[model samples]
Target: MTAKEIFDSTIKEIEPLYGNDEARSIAFSLLEHIGIMKTAVLAHQPMETDTSILQKWIERLKKYEPLQYILGETSFYKRTFRVNSSVLIPRPETEELMEWIIRDFGSVEEDFSEKPAVTIMDIGTGSACIAVTLAKEIAESEVFAMDISEEALKIAKENALRNNANISFLKQDILHDFIFQTPLDIVVSNPPYVTENEKSAMQANVLNYEPHLALFVPNEKPQLFYQRIATFAKKYLKPTGVCYLELNANLAHQTAELFDKEGFTEIIIKKDLSGNNRMLRAAL
Candidate 1:
């Protein structure tokens, strides 16, 4: 079949699962991934292409599998990072968190040579998207990323190398006490904030395909990671160091309160593009 036929058929098959706009978007992405241009498909041009791979991707899409996991990589903070079921796909809100850090610490015109070294750690560095982006965008940043899952760390390491972002990867659970060789200028995370109860509200693509260990906390203690992060920041963060976190919209205030109780004086919650309370900045 031609590119147009493949694209239209893929969209038709998945439209019920993803809705009109997203289905079209996914279909276009699948075609582009296989070397068919959107322009050709749109113009009804009959571009010859492989059908077997396309059919397989379409089958997965019908099952509501995330396209990023299917493609094995995604664009985050304008850079491509490899992703798999081992790690959660990087979200736009995380990019906003990165932007906030870059705005505060990065200069568009300066490179590492002119800036003093800063130490930053990502507590749950699933895919290392946050760590790699900071290491690339912020000059002279010594970045460390920690994840409990060795499989996730393997993918994260590959991403760091792929982007040429020098980062140290550690396989450690943040819930347990860990040692940092030096004080940190920033502690950042987009950790597991979703409670088990929230699973029903999430799309099947995310609920079924994304890594649950990276996405969820027990319903009884929804604030588990944030609590640990607060304690970790108190112990390891420098007096002037800051913490940036991507928060669950429903638990934003409670998460900030955890930092507040930890004596983070300058606690501020920031919203994402949709204006949900999605990010928090805290400092001593």
Candidate 2:
């Protein structure tokens, strides 16, 4: 088949499940990634592909597997992130959170003679996207990331290396062993906030393919991650430290209130590009 033929087939196969526009975008993205042009999709060109790999991708798409998983990577903050079942796929909203951090404390650099170096910790760091991005963008900041999953940490570490972002990764479960002796200049996270009751409304591509451990919490205790992170911030964050978190859009108020009750000052609930209250910032 020609590039057009494969592209058409890919979109046609995925459209009913994902949507016409989104399916077309995915099809085009895959083709572009493999350097397959619509005109050259056919085996007429030496570069054209008619491999079984195409069929396998179609089969995976039918199963509601994310295109990122199929491609084994996704773009976040204009950087490529390796993703799989072990780690939550990086999202655009998370990129906005990273951008906010970069904007507020680019380099977090001090004169060194007058003040101490900046220190940052990312709790529940999944693929290390936040940790790596901060390390790469804030050269003078010391970055540390903690995640519960060993498998996830493997991918996170590799992502840090691939991006050449020097970050320290620790296999510590935030729920139980959360501890930091050093005063933190900043603490940030995009923790599990999707409750079990909300799962029914989510798409299968997310519900089936994404790691639930990193995406969800029990229905009865929806704000557990926020509460825990808030407590952690209260303990470790310096009086001048800032805390940035990606909150569940629907529960933005509750998440921000957690910080408020924790005595964090200047608590701010910020909306994403989509106008959803998706980010929260506060200071100790």
Candidate 3:
């Protein structure tokens, strides 16, 4: 079949399950993967072919598999990240959060010293996106990351190595008793903040394909992770240390209130590009 024909056929099949735009993206992605072109002019040229592999991919997509998982890689912070069901796919807003961090700390090298030696901890570091990005961007920052899932940690470690970033990985459940051996200058997280009650409103690709443990909390205690992390920051973060979190937009006020009650000053609630209250920054 011609590239256009193949893409159109695929899009028709998936548009009902996903949406037209996403289905088109998937169609073009598959065509590009196999070197198919919209024009027969390109088809006349010798192109790579592995029909069996392509068919397998199509089958997976038909079942609503995320493209990142089917391909086993994603891009975050302009860098390629290895991702699977073991890790949460890095989102664009998280990249913006990293941008904020980079902007705030970029001048510290000249202001303080060549190697300022700041320490950061990432709680629930699924794919280690935040930890690795900070370690790569910061001049002299020591980064530590933790996750409760051993499977998730394995993927995160591979991602850190893939990015050529240095990060200390810990296999500890943040919900359980775990303490930082060293003081931290910054604490950051994009923890699971979605509530059980919110699941019905989520997309099927997300609700079905993504890990529930990394995406949700019981509706009865939606702020559980935020409270725990804030309490930990109070004890472990330095006096001037900063805490940042990617929050549930619907619960931004509640999340901000947690920090206020926890005695964190300068609490700032920032919206993502979509104008959703998506990130929070506070100083202890």
Q: Pick the candidate with the highest lDDT.
A: 1
Task: Kindly list the per-residue Cα lDDT of model 2 for residues 33-83, writing each as its tens digit.
Answer: 677865565454444565478778889988988989998998887688999
Distance from true location, Cα of 235 in model 3, Å: 0.9
Clash totals for all candidate models: 0, 6, 0
TM-score leader: 1
Displacement of residue 228 (Cα, Å) in model 1 is: 1.0
> Judged by lDDT against the true structure, how good is candidate 1?
0.90
TM per prediction: 0.95, 0.91, 0.91
Native RMSD of candidate 2 (Å): 2.6
Worst 10-residue lDDT window, candidate 2: 106-115
User: Candidates 1 and 3: which is better by lDDT?
Assistant: 1
Give the alpha carbon lDDT tens digit for every residue of 1-284 in model 3: 45555666677877887799887777777766666754542354444355566678878888878898998888888788888887899999999899888887773254546555889999999988888889988778889999999998998999899889889999988788775788898999999999988889998778889989899999899999999999889999988899989999999999999899999999999999999999999998
Error (Å) of candidate 3 at residue 142 is: 0.9
Backbone clash pairs for candidate 3 read: none
Residue 101 lDDT, candidate 3, scale 0-100: 81
